[model samples]
Target: MTTLRALTPADASGIRRIYSGAAVTYLMRPEMTASEAEAYVARVIEWSRAAPVAQYVLGVDVAGDLVGVVKLGRRPAGHGRVSYVLREDVWGRGYATAAVERLAAYAFTAAALESLGAKHHPDNPASGRVLTKAGFTCLGADGGFVHYWLDRDGRRESSGQHREGPGVSPGRTRCPRGRSSR
Candidate 1:
């Protein structure tokens, strides 16, 4: 089963390993060394420990192994910008879609956000597909990436059956003890 957990400094190693090579480099920028990833994780942990924080980042795990990360970053419009990354070895298994979907619901609730946006390199249709499966739609290109958005009502208006209401965000209240609510 897939799970989402609050990110920890320990995950740096896994993330460092994933963010390599030409393919991932095309999506994730400024490829980091193992030591740099560790430093980044340390920064994340420190910032999260600070109360009233705006950004929320979570590690994606499967069967107790770290596989990816999802972030709901604050936007100037009182909403969020979603971003996620997965271990290259675990690609094409729907984990990215599942993680982003859970995070989208959580953003609409836990953060009391109205909308969440995401962007992917135009060439990386796989990333775009993950967002689309998670309920985001194209919003054209911006800053060298194709953007997507998912609003509160858009999520609720879907033809697919859903239980979460305006107050029903995933990965936070719906998720118990960092478990996958998907």
Candidate 2:
């Protein structure tokens, strides 16, 4: 099961665990050091607690175990970007896709976000597939990364299932506790 909830300072440790594990994976190449990853987690926790304008950082976990994070942030009066990372141990388990789906739904509900999008390093097809499953389509290549967008209707152009974006995808999974999907 996947959940999207508000993250608290207490979640910093779990978030750190998730991201630290992630940094070693291909999803986040040129990984950061442990201390740096810890600092990164601290910042995410701070941001989640602060709830800055046009941004929401969430943590993703499964069955009470912290595993990943999903982030949705906008550039102040601009489009929002959705991004996620999962531990290598959980790869190929569909956790990434489920977390993205829940976060997309929350983005549509919590904020009047016009669209939710993400980008994956060109070398990472798994990331691309996860975003595609969440209804995001390739907008074009930018700075070597493939961009994707999911409009307000939850309709993802890249999914190829709908020409128009649907407000939310067909499934609305349960939101777990202990962490939010970033």
Candidate 3:
């Protein structure tokens, strides 16, 4: 089973292992070295510690092994940003969706956040699907990526007229393994 926990310095190697060139390119550009990856996690850990609300980063732990991360980013004007990354091998396991959902639950209630935002490259619709399953509604594309947002009380729409896109329907979501998000 996958569990969510606070990220620590010990998660460096596991994180280093997952943030491959292919994986990072989907979200970021740099192909990080082991030391760089360690430093990145360390920095996030430090930020989490310094935050008034401990809603910064969390590790996705499966059977005591770290496989991925979920982060609640502090955006300007009180909105939050939600993001996650998993090991490439674990891409289709529903882990990212579950982790994001876990973080959203915490952010909406315990952290007292008003709204959370996310974005994905237009080519990476899998991530959009994950965001949708985790309660984000697409806000169309900007700068080669599609944006999404989820507000408290389960609302995820930018306008009342538009509901879903392509083949998506309201309240309908597909898991990473191609199963329904039921």
True-structure RMSD, every candidate: 9.6, 9.2, 5.9
- Where is model 2 more than 4 Å wrong at Cα? 8-13, 20-34, 157-182
| lDDT tens digits, residue span 1-182, model 1 | 77889767778888787676553676657677999889888888887877766778788889889888888887665668898888788889999999998888788777778887777766777887888788875554545666666777665234333332222233322112211112
Model 1 spans > 4 angstroms off: 28-30, 155-182
Backbone clashes for every candidate come to: 2, 16, 0
Candidate 3 deviant stretches above 4 angstroms: 53-55, 161-182
Better of 1 and 2 by lDDT: 1
Give the number of the best model, judged by TM-score: 3
Q: Estimate each model's TM-score.
A: 0.79, 0.73, 0.82
Lowest-lDDT window of 10 residues in candidate 2? 173-182
lDDT of 3 by residue, 1-182 (tens): 77889878877888887787467878766666889978988888788768485458889988898888888876655568887888888888888888999989888787788778787766777898889888787665655566677777787654543423323344433223331222
Instruction: Score candidate 2 by TM-score against the native.
Output: 0.73
